[model samples]
Target chain A: MTSLTPMVAELVDYYDDGEAARHFQFRLLDQQQWPPPEPGQFFMLSVPGAGEIPLTFTQLPDQNQHWWALVRRMGSVTSALFRLEPGAILGARGPFGRGWPRPGSDQTPVLLIAGGCGLAPLVSQAERLLEMNLGPVALIYGARSPEARVLGRERDRWQHKLALFEVIEQSPGQTARRTPLDALPDVLAHWGHEPGATFMCGPEAMMTALSQRLIERGIPPSSIWLSLERRMHCATGTCGHCYLSHRYVCQSGPTFGWPELELLMQQPVTTQTPPLLSC
Target chain B: MIHYRLAELAELTRHLGRTRQVWQRSGAKEWCQADASNPPPLEAGRSVQSAKGFFFAEQEHIFEFDGRYFRETLPKPAPFALIGVSSCDLVAIAYQDQFFASDPHYQARRQQALLVGLECTVPCEHGFCPTVDAGPAARPGTSDLVLHPVGNGWLLTVTSEQGRKSLQGLNLTTAPEAMKQQRQAQLADCERQFPDDQHIRDGVQALNAGTVNASTWQQMGVQCLSCSGCTSLCPTCSCYGVQDQSADQTITRRRFWDSCLYDGFQREASQHNPSDDAGARVYRFWYHKFSDDFRKDFGRYGCVGCGRCEATCPGVIGIHSVMKRISQHD
Candidate 1:
């Protein structure tokens, strides 16, 4: 019988990352049956008293069965997760959902777009590209402010190797609220190459706007990928909570090509409705 | 497939009740445990509540975690028989069987239950089962035994090996071969008696053609109180939410019936709600019930035309009302 019961994972360590986010490392008690998770795949973390919440793997599990994720203290489950001390036990089940496919090529430039805490799912992919010595790879990470930015450590390491653009809504502590779109022109100009594939995660409006712009710039919807977040209970796809139309976002994707995502969102209501800000 | 002269349904029920619990449809919406000697009348009416609860319980503890280990909780229900279930409900049970085929907890309860489907001889107030391919007569293979009322007794068609085995001790005479044609005639008459549901057919078309306006849905959505009444009463709605209750370090995870019409049903911990708009949630609920994409997976539309939702919904978004509104839009 397939079970929702999760194997115990103890928190090894954690440190404050962004404004209300923490970088957490955990070591699973049992790894004998764990299928190696691809970057961008997520897991369900159970806070003993509070319920379960889905989190992506910012860092894949290593030899010691230690994996890491960048978690924002968003609600009950994450709040409970943040309250626990190092070595505190929690439950986890996953490596669920479709992850990012391999980049087209190291020689083919890849563009990365992220908004605020949305960077978590794409951070590992960026790091892997950097490690591969892939050139012309660019990242545009938009945040409310410098302090509101995340993965500061990962950014610092990639600065010399990456075509990085840290676009903030409020620049130098305070400025007119700008957006990633305001910086898209300059970022693309500097990269000076049409990206072969674009990976994105962020606010719904930001992702949709960027995807449209990319498609207008000659990128096929098939080559543009984005990670979507939805409410999920049973990651096994039995529970219908995470439906992106008929498809379960927890099963078929958290990551999807723009074309596939567009097709899934073809329900009449979605098109008629204006974009609403999504967390 | 076999025939039997059921001299008395009570006699057959009595023999089966010896080893298994027998629950027969009672009143308009309950299945009361029956006394073998005096079985309740098996009227050809719909049950607002179905046999769904017998397998996929409304609330259940799925698992428990106690510091060191997590243990799953699977129900072990005793062998039971559902007597005089209407055809629409039996079809819903068949649909759930395929959906929860991999779910062990559902299987444990399902495997022990023998379904006895009762064919409708006349249309019930809210039912239009024939329109959705569910029936006045039970569809073949949906139940273990199908009962068609004939003369002063019943014609029991044994559809499964389990049904045949359970009837071994019943003192039934062989039914006349002409009874089969008589059974067919009664079912056809019942089907013809169902009021025309042209709106339902047109609404299905309008829905699949994507012609219904959001404004119409919003109007209907406004009437919905999110009381979860329709979903609660719906036989095929299988969405659920999980909760964790902890005491003395033991965390027990419980799952309860959840409705997609509720705003929080698809709300994430990040406070992002996929169906934040009531209209969207309303549309999604109907979409799940009537969408052709869903039909491909379940072999039929999610709705069995039982009209439980129509009977229970306090709002105008019940199947009939919504279908009329949407089809009118077309």
Candidate 2:
């Protein structure tokens, strides 16, 4: 079942994907294809000396046993992870939490929104939808600037397959493109399809704003899903660090329907103005 | 279940210790390993800390990683008996039992320990067990054995098979069925003696109804120092964080008790914290204690009404204080 002890995943290779971020490919040394992770499922990565951090699977380990994660050099664990060599041994435990719900039988266009490195969680989903040849699937991604963008190679490939819109906050150095929100209307317009389901992950504000905008554009709150990031010590729900109301974000989510997440975020109300998704 | 009337409480303690390590009150608010030699009095007040540490150690090694493989470090505790655990503490143990049912490390220690519950003849200073249904007497199925102070002796009730077999050789006399009624009467009187807890009722209702103003929670958060005393003392609070340290090229991971009140408990490595607001933490703490959402999952509220948080909180945001504020706001 759930083991606190992580299985060793040797670093097969890695490459810089974005500013301070790397696309790490590791081979599951001990585990085989016993557990196949769905899109948006996360794993706990243990850096021998620096401790553990939760990362989403950009590429899940299949029969070949190659697992990929786009990890940003944020704190101690990632710092130690960045210091490792090609053959360095590390620890990984998971394929945990409720992953993104699969596309249903309904043939409604699926829209995905991601900000900065948040695109990692939705990569496989986009690929899955493309392979399935479902109604038009599109991804609207935003970054602070071109340099801050991640998964450059994936974006390049996705552009040919799906309706991909990349936006930047930087104005002068590059021709300014519409923000993710501004690009949303056009994406819907081009396809003449209102997304049956919208999946998003990013800064809290953007996700919240996007959910509200989706709702305004006549999408049900239940149809919008978001992946959350919280400090997770145990992906198994024993550690209450990832608690959101009665639910532990690590177990009940990492991905939650907008309505479900809104309920959790509203409890233990902290502000009279509005509930800040960051808190 | 079998019942026996015994003139000496020491005889039961001596019998239990013969087979397992005995832990009883060592000081007014402390419990430690002790034999039947110096048995501490079963006082009315609960210890400042609960017996949670017996099963869930405050700090323990989880796993060790050498350059190659990860090995789990499960605890192998000696068989032990916790003597004279209060009703509320027993309730809290049951709550933890359900929460850690799947955790191998917690189960490893918990399976080796026997719980002997003590019935409170009178209410403790900060207890509101009746309010939370945790009790003035041990709730059935929460303990292996139960002890009730009868008129000149003790009424020993065997609640579990473990309690029945542990005393195989001891000679005892069966109690009349009336003793059960007598015990109930004693508990009812004890419950009646508890102070008016309308505030607790009101506060819990307000919380579940989502009527308490956000600013009220914010004010309570302002007073909290994030000292973590309340959580440490709370019998059912079970949050943990893991740490890794290196020695001789091997990395050892130790899991230690963590507090949700700490700002960084939910702070991600990206510095994106969903609970960065102190008010959110304060509310989450009480919401866990009093929220109906948790009640549906745990079958009861997380707080067992031990009131350990009330005694340990330096800030006035203890159960009594927080409840008063919430109830008074309307």
* Residue-level lDDT tens digits of model 2 in B1-330: 799987887787788888888887654378877667656665545877788998889999999887898989898988889877889999999999999999998899889988888888888877899999888888988999888888877788999998898878999989888887788899889989999999999998888888888788888889999999999999999999999988998889999999999988887777667777788889989988888898999899999998888888899889999998998885
Candidate 2 is scored at a TM of 0.96
Worst 10 residues of 1 chain B by lDDT: B267-276
Interface RMSD of 2: 2.2
Off by over 4 Å in 2: A31-33, A173-178, A271-279, B177-181
- What candidate 1 gets wrong by more than 4 Å, as runs, is A30-32, A131-135, A270-279
Best by DockQ: 2
lDDT of the candidates, in the order given:
0.85, 0.85
Fnat of model 1, as a fraction: 0.65
Model 2: docking quality category? medium
Winning model by lDDT: 1
What C-alpha lDDT, on a 0 to 100 scale, does residue B309 get in candidate 2? 85
Clashes of 2: 0
Please tell me what DockQ candidate 2 reaches. 0.66
